[model samples]
Target chain A: MTGPDSSRIYTAALLIIGDEILSGRTQDANLAYLAKWLGVQGIRLKEVRVVSDDMAAIGDAVNALRTSYDYLFTTGGIGPTHDDITVDAIAAALGVPVIVHPDAQAILAGYYGDKLTDARLRMARTPQGASLIENPRTKAPGIRVGNIFIMAGVPAITQGMLAALDGVLPGGAPVLSRTIAAWTQESTVAATLGAVEKAHDGVQIGSYPFWRDGRTGANFVIRATDPAMLATVASALMAALQAIGIDPVDGEL
Target chain B: MTGPDSSRIYTAALLIIGDEILSGRTQDANLAYLAKWLGVQGIRLKEVRVVSDDMAAIGDAVNALRTSYDYLFTTGGIGPTHDDITVDAIAAALGVPVIVHPDAQAILAGYYGDKLTDARLRMARTPQGASLIENPRTKAPGIRVGNIFIMAGVPAITQGMLAALDGVLPGGAPVLSRTIAAWTQESTVAATLGAVEKAHDGVQIGSYPFWRDGRTGANFVIRATDPAMLATVASALMAALQAIGIDPVDGEL
Candidate 1:
């Protein structure tokens, strides 16, 4: 197994909380968004768990992941509804009380005016001593409780909150990647791929098979912390595919 | 916290294994498909975890989830490629040795004929004391080892394997659901929704908010094991929305 250099590697875990996602009513959009963003920031997304809108589950996952990773992010259950118990759950996990942030109250009060009901006031609540992540798309800001960053369930709003959080966390060297898509079956070139991966130091190759236009093929993704080795791996992969009489495409299909 | 009837409610946890999924290189299609399929089988998908294609991580997740739930389903890393180490991981988790099942070998032989290469033979491998889940779409079949179902990463192949294993697992009650979409923001009617949910027994209302065409609204999903309670809860939710002067639309908008 190819292991990361532990001393410099930054990692994160995302806890996606919602019954809608578990019930198949909603497809989670935040994982991919956060994964790509973290990758660019040179922080590896280590694990992702989608738990239902249950308090104990959320609390347990928060406690487990927050301590295990460099950073922990949670999406969903921050809304102004009965099921939105993320704040309470995190407080329980952190051994703290949920408190209303005056700044959050002012933001919601200005946004909704007379419509700022008690339910809306729920959005201002967070674990004690926690700061806030700015929600550029809405009045309710995302809560930052210790290492955990709790954001909205809505994709657009989560994106805005993530934007506000860009370049905030420290990270290591960004993972460099190059994709080689071949119009040939992956199994046919499996040994070649493995051999190439073994020959290269500090490089990992991932083969993703897909069926498109009534044809089956695979995309070889070469990833490494060192950018210089990516070309060597790519060239070897292309040559290997060609040796097997496959025409490799430069990018993903 | 509302606990399920321990004797009757069958729970499941999915461990999606792949570096591609963790790297955000591939959008997972198996979790939702399996969740809905398992719901129809009366099994509640309680939790889902996406882990990288690493041995220790896969082994830990398989061990934890298999013991925690009635059944555990894992997708990805079952293909005939270098990254496909799900079988080996599961075997180590079960304290068993990796072996090539004769039945699986025969099945692949029949499917691939003379084209069954050494790489293709990798698909015939599974843990000892395991049965095979038929794959009508391709040569490689899914493995059923103890409580864990090891499946392919490819979406179509995974679907075929799932279809083959459908109606095979013992389950309790099929959860029925009804959705009521309201053109009002969720916070405006959050209190009423919670009240309606509290009044209803054996029913769970999930509020999913969405913004479309400059309009903000929410879809309230009411779920219950009893089909009769679904109608009752739907009517009450409709009445609640109406009392708040918000027009509720039938089904999802």
Candidate 2:
């Protein structure tokens, strides 16, 4: 709840509400985007839960995450369809009545003009005393109630909603990262990588292995809140890999 | 836990452990593949939680999901690197000790031969009373402890582990799905879709909106365990879309 200058880390959790995702009918494109966007805001994405469109499931996850993280974001189930029950579910989770925000209804009315129907108006419903997150691409605005920000599932629309909230929430120092890749199996240099990470304070290194062009390799990502520490760790990792006769690339191979 | 023949739905939850995924540095490729694979086994992937590589995070998620679902599957953090603490974390969560499986050690020893290092042997570690989920491509096998199936982070390795697990778990009836796409805004047919779902029993429909080639459209997915009901709902949906003056395609456009 404090400002970005307070030097405390801010965290968030994402709840992806959709049966299509759970059914494997759709591959999620929102998690990576939200993670990167939150990182720029100086908030780390701590966790993510992908649940179905079931009301109780959404409500339970929303209640759990909204209490645990600094911010809780939900994507999907906010459209004008029968399956879009995000508003109703979140309201139930918050123990508040669902109300149609006057401004949201007005925006939908203006957007639809003479063709506005009851189903279309469903987009204006939100939890009591909620505000709107502007959807620049689509007329249906996203809802922001308590610590929860409900946005559309579509990547582009979620982007617009994120753009609307840019620099609005207070965040801590942005986490910085540097990558060093090598043309060797990760197991070959696991010990040195662990030792390097333990040698540095407030620095964490992640090893991601890949198989490309019939060869196995890995990329080491060093992260720290301070840029100087990140660079030092990255350099040390490169040296360590080179010591093992593995040529380390500056970035991903 | 009842078997698949008991006329009850079987469910599973997935726990994705990795810092790279939460840091926005890597996109998760395992969830969708696992979801589809579980579907074929007639086990529903009810929920998914993506947590960081921290021990406590992994342990807490494993405890939560393992109890809530019939089975819990975890991907990532099962490698030979320092960051790979999934075995230790899971062992702690289960209130058990981490032990090196002799069979896993023998397999790794046989595959790596003289090149086997301590780091490589770290892949043989698992929670107490755990069994191996064979990785046909890589010598490092997956770990299965109680209801938890610990797998590799790489897509290919995870596939091999799933293949080893084929027909091993008890599952309910396989969920079937039918998709209907129309080049019209979903709001136009929201009322009809909701009504049709209400009129049918044991059927659920999901509406996913999309914008392509500068045109608005949506795909309505109908899912049901019974093939007859699925077909009936699909026909009703197509007829409803036709009544609304929108031509619907049988599958996704």
Candidate 3:
């Protein structure tokens, strides 16, 4: 437990804040993008919570997840509207006061110029002592306080903010994966997958079954931190599937 | 806080269990479908948690959510693969022993006949004192223990399970919504939207902004339980947008 490798397992949680998402009116597009982006940063996204634009809901979830992971990120409810209460909720969660960040104010002022009203000025609010994450797509910046990062809900703005933070945070080894697919039921190869995973020390095999063209098929994704281990497990799994009279494809079918 | 309408404000939480979703290997198609389905059942999906297949992770999320809402619906991790640990994890969460549900066993046996092996038999396991939710598509039934529902990961299988559960659970008044879109910045109309929402009781207005074809636009979605109230709020919102000199469309742009 005290090994140096223990520190290599960095994890984060995302809190998606919007009524639109929970209402099924807006399909969330941020989770997969952030998950893949965090993977490239060697940080595993261990959990995600989608909550509506309620203060106590956001505050409770923020506190619960912020302490449980290496970092906590929130998206949505940071815009100028009254429903945009993320900054206030997060500030209350951290027992800090919401303040107008001068840098954010200046950025908004420059972007909007004469059109900047008090409503637009609401974008400058953040938790006390928080810094800003630049949004190249939008002038209003994202907020960062302690281990919690508050981002925009818009996919493109979120992407821009994520790009601004690339290689900025410390991370661990990026997890690698190899996929093997077959036009057979996952239940048919369940035992083989279990045995192969148990035989390997640090490999995880995930079975995703699908039905296409009136045929049942599955993709077996083997994930490991070490490239050599991943390659070895891939070969072993391919051999096992072949032995069962199923032709396995190297990538997804 | 105790009122005649209190009982009619039903709410639920969703727990999504899978590593494929957390790793970005698979985009979740279940949340939107379940959200809309639950909406039609008059259950407001209040919060959703997506966690990995790890036992402690799943167990913690289940307990945290089950007690907080009227119902808790979980999707994924009910398959036959070794990584399919939702049943055991949920049993641990409920502080109950895992038992082979007799009905589930019979169904799987009837479906697989001679092909039913040990791995396939694992689908028959459920928490002690659990009932079955019928899966019309796949023979392996979903599980219902107390207030928690354990359903399949596949979108189609989950849909079949939900169809089986139609009119089964007691729900309240279904929430209705009206959308008004305009080719204007959300910030430009944020104040008007806020005022309109404040004027209308029992209505929540959500502002979702978008950028398309080099122009910024936003959609205001007004939700209420009463159709009359919903229409009134929608009309007020549309008038407010128009007063701001933005042409409001009846639906999403």
Candidate 4:
């Protein structure tokens, strides 16, 4: 249950908005991208929430999560469709007025000439003081207000924007990890594992079970703030596993 | 964003409790599996929440989502580990005492004999009057009370217990779907797509982007409560795509 001691860790939470996703019509692809990417950069993903596009629900969720966490990421319900209400929800959450982003309108103006009707321009709407996140997926861009970034639900669009912003976002100290995919049961290595955890106070040891090509095995990942300490525990773990007649494949994950 | 319109549509939310996941030490596979499965059966996955194994957070999330949605599902914090506080959280949320389940105790007793110490036996604990969901992954089971179903975060066990409880639970009418996939920019057929959507009042026509092996395409799926309407709209969508000289790939998502 150990988390990164973020004296001011750039903590983030995700609030996924869409009834299509909630109804399971669309499988959300943003959670893993955010979680894994944030992990490497040391901006620990504190929490994640997936909610329907209902305005009340969305407003309540956004306000609650955004106020609590340092950063809040919202995906979906910002498209040019009747069901898209993320803009309204964001404004409602902040008790501000929703208005069209002049820059977003400019982005679309060049592409569609006069063909960009009211329906299409609807995507340009944003809450007060929100900045646009340039989207390569579609002309309609995502918006960021304070630390809350609202992005498209589509995986490609979300991933694209996140990649573009990853290096720029203020981050906590980066984490380093090493793992050994060991062919053994968890119980067999429990004692040594406990000792390793006890010795490395700053590191967290996690064991994940995976069925590899029809065979059952476990991946023992030792993570730490310090790379040197991680390697030390990793070396000890590999030796302990080998001593117990279990072969481990060392790899970085 | 159109969820199934049915009184039987059981709105469910997930409260995932585990620092292992939040710390990026674990990748949660349960949320998607449960969400997708529930969608097919017409049980709406209203929300999903991931929080660390903190008693206060877990308790708060359990109380919140449970009150908001028709059903609540929790995972990851009910284990033999010392940090597992799902039982305590559930108790705190429900304002009830947690007691050991006889069924769970029997299951654990058969496996561990005298080795089933207090730490191990702790798995038997559940909020008062809650029923246990049998775990195929481990001896430690999950609990359910007042529409809240708590299960292990591990995929196999969650799926197994969900399957086991399928018949006992009520569900909305299953959603019927029809899909058309082929090479077409969503913008290219926006007008016609909108027309199709307007005509098919009962059916929902959704355009999804797909790129595989460098070939770009879009999958337009028509979903509705009525099977015949879904088929009709799907056929019309295919005809329109073909009429525009757009060759659609063969498949459904």
Each model's TM-score, in the order given?
Answer: 0.95, 0.97, 0.96, 0.81
A18 Cα displacement, candidate 4 (Å) = 2.8
- lDDT winner between 2 and 3, please give it: 2
Candidate 2 lDDT over A1-253, as tens digits, reads: 2254847989999999999888888899999999999999999999999999888999999999999999999999899999999999999989999998999999998999988899999999999989999999997999998888999999999999999999889899889888889889989999999999999999998999988899999988888998888888888888988897888999877
lDDT of 4 at B228: 81
Worst lDDT 10-window in candidate 4 chain A: A1-10
Query: Model 2: what is its DockQ?
Result: 0.87
Q: Model 1, range A115-149, lDDT digits (tens) per residue?
A: 88999999999899999999999769999988889
Query: Residue B88, candidate 2: how far off, in angstroms?
Result: 0.4
* Candidate 1 chain B: 10-residue stretch with minimal lDDT: B1-10
Which pairs clash in the backbone of model 3? none
Query: Which residue pairs in model 4 clash with each other?
Result: B182-B248, B182-B249
Q: Comparing to the true complex, what docking class would candidate 1 get?
A: medium
Each candidate's DockQ: 0.78, 0.87, 0.83, 0.35
Interface RMSD of each: 0.9, 0.7, 0.8, 3.6
On residues B11-124, what C-alpha lDDT tens digit does candidate 1 reach at each position?
Answer: 999999988888887888888898899888889999999999899999998998999998999998988889889999999999999999999999989888999899999999
**C-alpha RMSD of candidate 3:** 2.7
Among these predictions, the greatest TM-score belongs to 2
- Write model 4 residue lDDT over B78-136, tens digit each, in one string: 65544556888889888999888899899989988987777677788888988888777
TM-score of chain A of each: 0.94, 0.97, 0.96, 0.90
Instruction: Identify the superior model by TM-score, candidate 2 or candidate 3.
Output: 2
User: What is the lDDT for A65 in model 2?
Assistant: 97
DockQ leader:
2
In order, what lDDT does every prediction score? Answer: 0.90, 0.92, 0.91, 0.76
